[model samples]
Target: MKVLVTGGSGFIASWIRKELLARGHSMLVFDHQDRRQQLADGEEFFLGDVRDATAVTEAAAHCDGIIHLAAVLGTQETISNPRPSAETNILGSLNVFEAAAQYNLPTVYAGVGNHAFRLIGTGCYTITKSAAEDLARMYNLYRDGGRITIVRPVNAYGPGQSVAAPYGTSKVRKIAPSFACRALAGAPIEVYGDGTQISDCVYVADVATAFVNALEYTAVHGPTERPVEVGPIESVTVNDIARLVAEQAAILTGREPVAITHLPMRPGEIPNAVVTSDTSTLKQIGLDAIDFVPLDEGIRRTVDYYAQTWLPGYLAA
Candidate 1:
């Protein structure tokens, strides 16, 4: 099968591309940026924005399947600039969906469970993403453009994960990378609002595998609009995440254990957020809940990746 992955330069999208290629699928990466990973003989890239209908349609012509992963994410970024977030996350996504409709291409959409649990606190990101989800459903219903399966993932993080850091911005709102970097530098692991807020930190590789499974399921079976929740069976509190990252970084860097500090809760902080998934539903799509990477081990692996690959260049820059 030939696949077109929008936002292919992104961390999770990169992993999806790798997973697809490993399954012997030819790939065409469509993104505004250049490919971060080198393309193999069967892979190619088309540089363009997802908002451009012409560009998206032309790109969609080159593949049999589509994985829509392009979005402007991050609470602070969305809060600071809602217009761009809406334009990209909502309008850009519409372009992709419309192209999928035009081409009658089977598509797998990446969704967020946070959008459904608005009690956790909603922001511009949530609003736009939620709207995008609605558009996906509309396309699935009206267009009859092949199959579209929506998979909502929770707090995806691991090696090669890219936090929401725009070029001219200094704020890093993501928790995992922030904690990992601070720990490696022997800085205190800072938590907000007494560190009680909970998160379902799913491993990136596992999420990638889920995407592959989703693609395959749709390809073999047919279009199904039922949303599939992809996340861990367990949840970890903010304080536990901080402590675990600190401990793992200390071991990897040969540094003293870092202290966990508390700060005022940010505006969009969720008091407690948990993700629940139907394991039987996941199994139908070829995913098993028992395969999720444990939090402690995920943190260790992430710390190692940062220590050996990302941190050195990050600090020097």
Candidate 2:
């Protein structure tokens, strides 16, 4: 299959691209930025934004299916700037769904699992993502749309995740990268609130596999009646994550563990909120064989990546 992957230059999409190529599928990468260095030989690249309906349609024209992953991410980032989040997450998703309907293509919609946790998930990012999921379902039911499988993943983290500002293009502060980068530099690891918020952190590779599996299922069995959720099913507190990153950094750099500090919870964030999901649906899509990377190992790998790739530059800066 020739798949059109929106946000193909992003972290998770990089792993998805590898999975696609390994499975003998070609790619048509559609993103606002050109990270052609990530593209494998013979795969095509289309420079465009998902918010541009015409551009999305043009990219869809040449692909067998679509994997819509582009969006303005970050809870605090989105909360501070809701318009872009709504425009990108909601409007951009609509454009992608419309293009898929036009092309009669099978598509995999990336979603946030916490959007379903009504009480604590009322932030701008969750609301916009929830709206986008609704749009996907509406397109499938009312618009006579093509098969659209929604894969809602919990907190996804891994080696290739970008850091904030001067270090990387991502403006969002993700937990894994934030802690890993700080720890590697022997800087204090900052935890929001009491650091007890429970998160089900799934590795990027596993998340990518789930997307591909869901995509394959849509191609074979048509659209799923409900969104398929993916996660490790195990939970960890925010403080646990910080400590783990510090420990791993110490091992990697032969430095003492950094201090873990607590800050008031950021706006739009819920303190001690447990974000998780029922991942049984993954089994239906043939992902029962996956051995999810444990959190400790995943963090070690993430810290190692930062220690080797970005820490030196970051420390020098």
Candidate 3:
């Protein structure tokens, strides 16, 4: 199978590309930025924005299937600027669906499991993502019969993840990398609002595997009633994640474990987040979470990766 992955340079997308390639699928990447990473032999790259229908259509012309992952990330970034987030996340998704519809191609898109239910607040990211999911459903309704599989994954964190987006000298923070950075620097790991908010953190490898399986399932059986939810079954609280990162970072960097401190929770933040996926359905599709990386082990690996690969260079600069 030949696959086109949007946002192929992103954290999880990179893993998905490798996993798909390992499965003997030809791959093409369509992304806004110049290819920051080297491509595997026989893999191809195209520079384009998902917001452009012409670019998306041309990119999908030679591919048998599509894994749509391009979007503006980060809660704060989306919340701070809703317009661009909506334009890219929601509108960009419509463009993909349109292209897929035109080519009569199967598509497996990235969705957030949290957006499936009514949460405390609908932040810009969730709003746009949910809208995109709806658009996928609409495409299924009206398009000329193409398989549209939606995979709503939990928080995906691993090596090659970004802690901050570099713009000039300022930085926009992300959760896992932020905690890893503080742990490496011997600073306190800050937990918001007493640190009891639960999050389902799934390793990138597991998430990528689920996505590949989803694409395969779509190719065989077509679309299903609901989006296939994929992630670890167990949930970890924010405080526990911080402590684990500190412990792992201390071991990797030869520094003392940092204290876990509390700050006031940000506005529109949910008190607790518990992610649940349809495991029976996932099993039917041949995806099992039994082999998933445990939270502690995943944190250890992530911290070690950041400490050895990123922190030293960051400190020197």
Candidate 4:
């Protein structure tokens, strides 16, 4: 099968690309970043913005399936400029699905989840991504062109996670990236609030495997009727993640952790954010939960990766 991964250069999307190659499928990575001109060795790269109907149509034209992963769903990125976030996360996703429908490409919506609990907190980012999911489902029902499934993974992190700095309160903290960067820098291992807040984090490799699994199911079963595949990744607490980071850093750098301290939990921090993909629909599509990697091991590997690849520069910063 031919699969197109939008945002294919991103940490998670790249993992999906890797999984596809391992499965012996042809892959076209559809990315808009100027710096991502080169595919990661195996993928056939296509340059396109999900915001462009034409570009999305052109990219969708060439693939048997698509894992739509591109979106600016970060809180700061979204609330900082709601227009672009809405356009990209919502409108951009619409184009991808419409194009998929037009060309009848098998489509899987991978990697979109809410940090904020929609029923409780201010939820611009959640609202937008949720809308995108809804649109894809509707397309599946009415258009009758292709397959549609959504993998709403919560707190996806592992090796190759983002290290970009934050923009606002809405952005919150870069939990995994910031923790790894701080630990490597020998800076205090910071925890916001009591650090008791629990959340689920799916390992990128496991998520990539989930995508591969979903792709296989979709191909065999055809587009899910009332189509959707929901996967709730493994969950952990912020404090536990920090402790694991400190532990791993001590092992990696051959020194004790500099500090483990707390900052006030910022306003709008969800007390506990737990998300599950709609479970009833999973059996309908012939899907089940993928084997989840344990969180401590996942963080250990993530810390080791950032340490080797980005630590020297990150510490310099």
Q: Please give the lDDT score at residue 231 for candidate 4.
A: 40
**Rank by lDDT (best first):** 2, 3, 1, 4
lDDT of 2: 0.85
**Regarding TM-score, does 3 or 4 come out ahead?**
3
TM-scores for all candidates: the values are 0.92, 0.95, 0.94, 0.87
Please report how far candidate 4 places residue 241 from its true position, in Å.
Answer: 0.7
Off by over 4 Å in 4: 40-42, 166-173, 224-234, 275-290, 314-317
Query: Candidate 1 lDDT, tens digit per residue, 65-182?
Result: 8898988886656777789779888888898888888888888988886776554466788778888888888877777674688888878888876543431133546678888887
Off by over 4 Å in 1: 119-121, 163-172, 275-280, 313-317
Q: Which tens-of-lDDT digit does each residue in 156-218 have in candidate 2?
A: 899888898545667788888888888877789989999888887888998888888888888
What lDDT would each prediction earn against the true structure?
A: 0.79, 0.85, 0.82, 0.72
Best by lDDT: 2
Which residue runs does candidate 3 get wrong by more than 4 Å? 117-119, 165-172
Q: How many collisions between residues are there in candidate 4?
A: 1
| Candidate 3: count of backbone clashes, pairs at least 3 residues apart or interchain | 0
Q: In angstroms, give how far residue 228 of model 2 lies from its true place.
A: 1.6
**Candidate 1 global CA lDDT score:** 0.79
lDDT of 3 by residue, 1-317 (tens): 99999998888999998999899998898899888467887589999999998999999898999999998875656677789879999999989998888888889999986784434675688888888988999888877855798888888889888766431122446578889888888888887788887767888998999899888988888876678787776767878788889889888778789999898876546666555665555774687787788888898888888888877787887
Residue clash pairs of candidate 3: none
RMSD (Cα, Å) of model 1? 2.4
Worst 10 residues of 4 by lDDT: 164-173
Give every collision pair in model 1: none
